[model samples]
Target: MDSTIRTAIAAADGDDPYRALRQLHHARIELTRELDRAEALAVRRARTAGASWQVIAMALEVSKQAVHKKYGRG
Candidate 1:
């Protein structure tokens, strides 16, 4: 079990934990940004396809105002 813990905690690259941690965090940020872009594109497509703000909001599980506030101007 100790070996499992060690492996889980081990630096992915050499013994530089900081570099490994930074890489992981950067990857997460990049993925989040990519997802946001994809979501925005999807919203645009939906809007172009005659989907209402309320409908989009419901699909996104957010309020109409919230969805409009986020993407209406764009």
Candidate 2:
């Protein structure tokens, strides 16, 4: 994981384990959302660069249909 993320997690709610855990979970969810946004941007860029859905899907380790289903339309 990134050092900044680690630092943020470590700094959160040091007083209680349950609070720390909840903070960590929230941090993870935020990171997951960021990753999803980045992935969608990559897909959009690939499409704009003239890459086929099959190629993008294969690069992402998913089926072409899956990629299209997720990111094909505007």
Candidate maximizing lDDT? 2
Which 10 consecutive residues of model 1 have the lowest summed lDDT? 1-10
Give all candidate RMSDs, comma-separated: 7.2, 3.0
**After aligning candidate 1 to the native by TM-score, how far in Å is the CA of 69 from where it should be?**
0.5
Writing each residue's lDDT as its tens digit, candidate 1 over 12-72 gives 6558888767666666666678789999999999999999999999999999999999999
Q: How many clashes in each candidate?
A: 0, 0
Clashing residue pairs found in predicted model 1: none
Instruction: Identify the candidate with maximal TM-score.
Output: 2
Model 2 pairs whose backbones collide: none
Off by over 4 Å in 2: 1-4, 11-15
- Each prediction's whole-model lDDT (CA): 0.80, 0.86
**Backbone collision tally, model 2:** 0
